[model samples]
Target: MTIYRELVIHLKEETMKDIELLVIYQNAKTLLFHDSKQTNTIEDFVTGCIHHYIDRVKHQIDLSGINDLGKPYRLQNHLKEYIDKKGISQAMLAERTGIGASNLSLIMKNKNQPSLDYFFRIWIALECPPLDKILYRVEE
Candidate 1:
């Protein structure tokens, strides 16, 4: 099977299980975390897991005497572009997505990076807008 296919299957299986763990951060640790109840948090965590899987696959491909697979996909700020293209004001987007207007302002101004949860909310608010011009679609 292709690496990408295998990775997708693995993630789907993992997502079905209840996960509990302790995460150690920079200097502190979150104690006995057993996932989140919020949809955004759960989606964000699942997105992170997908990213982790992709990275591991890429690293494996690299170590197997193959050509370099290049870097993981990273999102640049494209809120303004999307807003203009969709003909929506930042306030409207904020209201639709339930993200704070102030936070949306910060995102547009590049003052803050958005979490996956926030980004997904924006994407859904925009009626599942295409990211072809917004994010890198890394291919194997």
Candidate 2:
């Protein structure tokens, strides 16, 4: 089935608001809408909505376990998972955030702990949820 049908099913299951659905549906439509198209069909509308919902779901799932780091080691694992999912190369992230790839690599490998500034830069580059939600302090 198309993305729109999937979104309609999800919306029906969750009973989402029409306005909310319209806003999300429009974003997808804007991306996929073509001047060659004659009219917007139900399938097209539904596809747009589904695409938007999928994007939102991906972002939300990406933030999972961000607040559950109990140890420095666990934090490193979380970072690794995030980096893998985000498809961000260490060198690219470092360049974008003005940090050294070696430092990011060390942090991901659990050999080093990043300072707040470094963490903030990484967070911004990843666009990952709130920094506090993604970070945990190790207990003594």
Candidate 3:
């Protein structure tokens, strides 16, 4: 059976960019199934999501002040929780992701915000393809 899920990824300046690339699709087997295209890369997945929105434009979404070019929404950091549940140590994660334990710590504490490049690195290293509680949209 197919289920409809809404994902709002709000990457703020105070959040880790790498966390955005996590292809966490804890829903259906057809992850990001925009036209049944498998998103081989983060760009593809993102583009698929955009295309999905465009395809469903007639669904009537609340685009209040969308043309105002508003700032991005605040993101809820759940990487630490994800890591804890995975039973992976920060040192091990740093080694696997090459992101440095200190930087990882800052991200967990919501201190440092890295660039977009790190997203792919983290996603690739962690090999995680599920999001669910790993991230969510926090409309501020």
Candidate 4:
């Protein structure tokens, strides 16, 4: 089998057990796997899988809705807070990250989901320590 097929199989065996993965896989498979005429490269499959995972995670979070008591945190809010605390403007952040100010605003407003590259750029611009703290948290 090709590397792409192998990766799909591996993900199915190892990661599909999780509900999140299952949803992601189903959505990704529907959207990406249908195009058999396209190149069946490992990179293609991996990219699709990664996108699926992101979509699934976003969907799950959206289903939960915004917490009124501020129990659950969001990346947009975290970024805004960081910007406020650091007294940095969006234009400054955009310059530091090499992203357009409008793009940064869209991301901050949660109107667009940034790719990993953009995320890293923002992270580095913020100089946030304990990166995991910014990315995730334990439910109380």
Best by TM-score, which number? Answer: 3
lDDT of 1 at 46: 58
Poorest 10 consecutive residues by lDDT, candidate 3: 19-28
lDDT of each: 0.61, 0.65, 0.61, 0.65
**Clash list (residue pairs), candidate 2:** 4-46, 4-47
Kindly list the per-residue Cα lDDT of model 1 for residues 2-50, writing each as its tens digit: 5533234344544454432212231133222544332334445556777
How high is each candidate's TM-score? 0.43, 0.44, 0.45, 0.40
Clash pairs of candidate 3? 18-119, 24-130, 24-131, 25-130
TM-score-superior candidate, 1 or 4? 1
What is the clash count of model 1?
0
Model 2, 1-140: lDDT tens per residue? 65522222444644546645775666567667753334455556666776878977675543234455653333433565677777877888789889887888987776887888987788888885544444544433
- Weakest 10 consecutive residues, lDDT, candidate 2? 2-11
The lDDT, on a scale of 0 to 1, for candidate 1 is 0.61
The runs of at least 3 residues in candidate 4 whose Cα sits more than 4 Å from the true structure, single-residue gaps closed, are 1-77, 136-140
- For every model in order, what is the number of clashing pairs? 0, 2, 4, 0
Q: What is the lDDT of candidate 4?
A: 0.65
Q: Residue 100 error for model 4, in Å?
A: 0.7
Model 2 misplaced regions, further than 4 Å: 1-77, 130-140
Better of 3 and 4 by TM-score: 3
